[model samples]
Target: MTNHNLYLRLVGDRFEKTASQPFLIIPGRRPLLFSELDRMTGCVAARLLELNVEPGDRVMVQVAKSPESVLVYLACLRIGAIYTPLNPAYTTAEVSYFMTDSKPQLLICQPIERESLFDLSLACKVPHIRTLGSDGDGDLMHGLESLTPEMTVVEREADDLAAILYTSGTTGRSKGAMLTHHNLASNAEVLHSYWHWQDQHDVLLHALPVFHVHGLFVALHCALLGCSTVYFLSRFDTGQVIDRLPDCTVMMGVPTFYTRLLSDARLTPELCSKMRLFISGSAPLLAETHREFEQRSGFQILERYGMTEAGMITSNPYHGDRLAGTVGYALPGVSVRIADNNGNELPRGEIGVLELKGPNVFKGYWQMPEKSAAEFRQGGWFISGDNAIMDQTGRISIVGRAKDLIISGGYNIYPKEIEAVIDTIPGVAESAVVGVPHADFGEAVAAIVVKDGSRQLGEQEIIEPLQGRLARFKQPKRVFFVDELPRNSMGKVQKAELRDTYKESFGSK
Candidate 1:
């Protein structure tokens, strides 16, 4: 396993031990065994080479979570081509931005996404474009049927580039985070060993979008490494999840997905009886939401923390007490610290920036050496622009994003503190708080809230609940009730858009 390529170690090395093991079950589709997946991936790898895709060439895949998507990803990795996956739901503008930035040689997409990719490819100067289904005429999957299955696996060193994941930047421009073979493979090994991943026993319910690191690497890699079965969901549906929970031992999702499942009345305790672990990530999990889930489901959600650059950095202990509202201790082989604004280390329990250094830290942003150098300090520590505090128990609590902080009347205010207070109120579903300009104070705290449509809660009603919980200055001076807060495809709150919309509302000094 150590001598072979990372993809080979994940898919081929585990093949003999679980050759006949069910590796995937696509609902109505037939279950694919480990040996079957390995063969199909080998065929796909041969197809990639036939297309003139050489080692180190970027291959961007745009598809929904299906067996084919997994095949495409693994195949590229096996052939030593760097894989970049984008959400099929991205807008034309977003697609163009990524295409231009990545400069990928090949773009694999579905029919609907192909139209946007094609339009973007022309303007972005991308050379090759391929789509799925027969209507596209020159689809990769269809074209591969003519080629003979090749067993050649391009050898890759641990330090070789494996994938490039693009995350939202502070300036609203997308920047690609470069991940190496060692970064991903090391994290997967840690997760597999520490979480007790077994080749024969685990069945993962993979409902999270594959565009994010959590879904693509952590969830999918875990199953591949352990030779476990993954039931991929095209999109998260609470009803579908409840129906499938009986067959799966592990399920991974974001906080919103868990909240939706809890809202669905059909999800009974009996439906979740077979699950061994329910993991949550990609966003902060509220303490109140965590409590409600445990009270109702009788299974504690094992909350893990990760980002687009690095894979799984930390996870709640698999055996110990899983604390509420905390992203448990750092995973084995990962080191984390709290740093001040000047890059000096901060004491525990002090709110400061989170810095991480480990085998999982990415190689850096693509084509942005200046910005990449700024992200790291002296000892290979990547400074995450997120404010956090490490408790005495070594648990981490993310307070708010560094850019999201609001300072009103010379008092520093964190939006997560206010959001948590408001989220506990009865009718409030979710909320986003940002700082708006004001003449008196340097800035005024403002909130945009989403409420349950069945009940209408006024600004006063929302403000009243947070009166005691938050300081007077921290309370939002203006509250706008919207049906839903604007979110990116990954369900992240687009605070920049909110700040732009209310710019005129805050009078000039």
Candidate 2:
């Protein structure tokens, strides 16, 4: 039967077309071909069926970077299962919440973390637990051995949930953005055309985490759709990326990656001569960082705007002026407009709430019908919580975030979540979390706390309790003890004042 699965269509069909071509390469490992990937994912897909992971069953994978991780996702897709990926750094407490919410049939973690995750998975009532390491050998693959299973691709609808990516609102609790097969497929196809990629010949440098949409869906989907070869690295390392920069034709990274590259003297134009494009997203890139990278590397970084809800909204022209400080025009087939609180469209150059409607947009927030209803308008336009301004030329620039969430090093760090934990501490009366400018990370989490009476708390004392309570990236980098937090007339904590007051907290360091 012809495969209706999006993965089989985009990846498998293309893999067959380029059967012997090498599609993936790690630093020291042997190059992986399209044919090898087809076989590997097929084996994993058959194993998933044996485990009773039926169509629509969510498979939660929270393992370190590995080839098996990618295979697991493709396997889930081929079988019509919903794939959910969580950050490996998430603590057991964090894992429990996600597990309870998603109620997955299987929970997979790194082999090293199997001991700690055992009790949590049971508590959450997850049926099965599996292990996968960086090299891809684990209980899941071990159990699949010697069993010949069919590779029949399950038929799925366009609206079927492809993946559930967790994002947060002003509140701390995460809301899963249910991305459909159409949502992912259309975005990748649009990006393929917009970027003007050449199949099998274009080389992509991938360093972002597979858990996030930027890496898992956007980067991977684009590569798969274009049949581009990917140099998949575990994480963003300064020396590693720079050493391979000249060999790659395209790279997609956060602002942090570009800033780090600019710091190195070896990031010369000649070194990046082979690179055709460098795309930055996940956080706002400072205009200075954009110019400095261009002066140093002789290439203008293409900045784009996107969210977990909408795969990718707008991008700067690939051949035209790559603007600094502004994410360029809305993507083809996507409608972006500046609007007021009531969703009325505003004139150009006026900063307001940015809303968009397109096939690339997600279905809605998973399981929250009311919330899902509230975020959309009459004609199905989704309210993007970003504050943006549009120029006469239709270029869009973000001014502020209404959610007060911090995007540091390409990860979303919600302040209220951290503040909830801080407020519980004995000496802390109230706390406010804000992201301040940092040269390395686009923004560094800086927290301001007020003490209750004479109790004096050191920075480490305040930071100690948050170690296991929150993810390391969400924790505040620096804590400042203040008399009281600044507030407006409505008694709302004025985060703007706090940001301006501590803008230079990372300055000169």
On TM-score, the leading prediction is: 2
Candidate 2 per-residue lDDT, tens place, 1-509, comes to 44457876666656767777767788778877877776778889888887899989999999988667888998899889999999998998888988998999999998888999999888889999999988867898896657675477788888889899888667888998998888888888898899888777788999989998899888888888877788999999999999888779999999999988888999999999998999999999999999999999999999999999998999999999998999999999999999999999999989899999999899888888899999999898899988999999899999998679788998888899999999998799999999998888988999899999757698987899998988899999999999899989999999999999999999932
Off by over 4 Å in 2: 1-4, 143-145
Each candidate's number of clashing pairs is 0, 0
Q: Give me the overall lDDT of model 1.
A: 0.80
Compose the digit string of candidate 1's lDDT tens values, residues 167-244: 656454668999998999999999998888866789999877777688889998899877788887777887888888
Scored against the true structure, residue 210 in model 2 reaches a CA lDDT of 92
Q: Candidate 1: where is the Cα deviation over 4 Å?
A: 1-4, 133-138, 405-509
Q: Which pairs clash inside model 1?
A: none
On lDDT, the candidate that comes out on top is 2
What TM-score fits each model? 0.79, 0.97
lDDT of each: 0.80, 0.88
Residue pairs clashing, model 2: none
Span of ten consecutive residues with least summed lDDT in model 2 = 1-10
